[model samples]
Target: MAEKYLIGVDGSEHSRVALAWGLARAAERNADVELLHVADDSFLSESVAFLSEAQQASQQMLDSETAYAKTLGFTGNITGTAVVGHPIAELEAASKRVDLLILGAHSGSRFAGSFFGTRAVKAAATAHCPVAVIPKHEVSPGAGIAVGIDGSEASKVAIAYAAEAASMRGVPLIAVYAWMAPLTPGLEYLWSEELVEAQRSAAEEAIAIGVAGLAERYPDLTIERRIVQSPPVAALVQVGEEVETLVVGSRGRGGISRLLLGSVSHGVLQALPCPVIVTRATA
Candidate 1:
């Protein structure tokens, strides 16, 4: 079967933006687009209590989204599905068959929490394929793409995905390696310039290794590498403003084994101005 692009839409402006971005990408790749809306079963009781008028309004919104998707040139085999279940579960089950999953950073729903809601976080962390969390703001067309690296196997996967995305979008790839000086006993106050320099050198080496590996795989891709002295999350968010997408591993070397989302990936998803893609080590 041909690969299909799946986009989760919840009848919000932010979701529409995500839909638009997905459509643009699908067109570029000549792939089919599927619009999915997962109605949380937990809301069924509350929705019924609100009256049939509220339910009708919700249905109307879904209809509007379906129409909008068609107007955006996604018709024919383009599918629209509305399933009653937990948002994360539905998407995760459906994502197993899709090539990519696109989601909005915000849905404007009261139940939708900040940074694309908890469901999106879960999906990005556990989905079999890559997840792109579209930012709520407007960004320049074909801006640079940034990928965070920490010299881990998962980070290398993210770097590879970012390299391909940059080549496909015809944009520069920025490989960022963020680092901080290790905290040693009694050395917190006596942290000298030498320690900082050493940390910076290590960060540069990490970035160099990641860039070299990606260059070996994608020799024709344009890449710019950077080693920054800051927290991983802060550096990614600050650099993501001018980029079209920020790619990072779901977990890094500092993350716990059982943890699904790493600190850097979580922070970038929350604060970045552009889309963020979380890639898995094996994927």
Candidate 2:
């Protein structure tokens, strides 16, 4: 069976970008595309004309998105559906069975809702599969895939996902690990150059452990491991800017905040220059 991707559409240019990006990816993967829209009844008053008109408007928006997908050169099966409910709830329920779920970084209008808020955060955190957040610009394919790591199990899963994606794209894989030594501003000179080098070496070793055995799994993949002495979010954004896609674990586990996107992941999500995939760790 062909792979399946679900995209949340809301008739905005952001949604348009998501549709185009999703379709292009589907075209490459020969996957089926499903466009979903939630018709929030909160915008309607208790009137007959308001309800009927709202339904018509919702249908038109879905129609426009369906037509837009065709123009993006997607030859696979495309299905569009509009359900009446909270946007987050509807999308969450509908995305459970798809191979991937995609949405624009922003929704409706500048004031309507934000993809960085509860809707996207919760959806991505709880989604059964992977979620791709596409920005509101025409993103042509760039270099390879980049994955953020910090030696967590979630990061390991993200690396695996990114490796598969890089392999499929026939591009190199960039494994990024960001770390920093505890130092006081004025006391920085206390640590010798050897100490800094040791810190870096430790970080590099952790990264190697994180990416260990991947070469055997994907012999054709060329992996470039990057270890930087900086915050995780900053390092990821800097490296991810040059790549076509950035993949990270959806959140971190409990104690240190590692499940799929913790605070660091959220920061990267807000500042990322390109598309990002927040992948859940599978059992």
Candidate 3:
């Protein structure tokens, strides 16, 4: 079966970028693309007349987006849908039926509603499948793929997804493990250089374990392992700046807090470095 990708469209520049990105990926993967536009009902009273107007507006927006998609010249199957409801709730519900959900980063437009901004983060975090947040204009034309690793089941799943993506694109994969020395309250004076070294060693081990068999699995793929001594967000963002896509777990191990969807994922999104794919562990 062909893969399916759902995209949230709001008739904004950001959503247009997302639609373009989704269409490109769909063509490469021979995946189906679904464009969704949700009209915010909260802005109007629940009167029947108001609801009717919202429905008409929603259809108009969907029609425009559908027409826009055609202009892009995508030959694959494309579906356009519009609903009069909450964007976040509608996207979260639709995400379960698709392989991936793609959305554009928030652009501070009230017309965009929940398709971007903090709501986009919330949707990505709670979605049932992997969510890709396409930045408005920060994608590197032909950079490699990168994934954050921290010795967690979530990170492992991310590694698998990133590896497959890199292999498909025939691009190198950069696996990064960022670590910082653990600090104890009131024990700051006891901290020593030895502790820092120990932490560095552990970070290296974590990344090694995280990508143990990638080489053998993708013999033709070039994998670069990076062990950085910076905070996870900073490390991932710096790497993201130079990569085509940055893949990270929805949530990671508590100790490292390297890829927690709530904090780390949110932080990376704020940077808007590149297209970030937040993958959740499968059941």
Ranking by lDDT: 3, 2, 1
TM-score of 1: 0.85
**What lDDT is obtained when candidate 2 is compared to the true structure?**
0.78
Question: For model 1, which pairs clash?
Answer: 105-116
lDDT of 2 by residue, 47-137 (tens): 8887777677777878987887787778899998866556766766787879999988763465222333456666676677888888775
What C-alpha lDDT do the candidate models reach, one value each? 0.77, 0.78, 0.85
lDDT tens digits, residues 1-283, model 1? Answer: 6669898877777888898999888887778878777656664565655545444554555677778988887544577776556677678788888989999876446532122666677778767788998877888777888999899998888888889889888889999988877667877987888878877888888888888866677777788988887888988888888888889887532223423677778777767568888888762
lDDT, residue 55, model 2: 73
Worst 10 residues of 2 by lDDT: 251-260
Per-model C-alpha RMSD: 3.8, 3.2, 3.3
lDDT of 1: 0.77
Candidate 3, superposed: residue stretches over 4 Å from native: 110-114, 252-260
- Misplaced by over 4 Å in model 2 are 46-52, 107-118, 138-142, 183-194, 252-260
Q: Quick one: best TM-score, which candidate? A: 3
* Root-mean-square deviation of candidate 1: 3.8
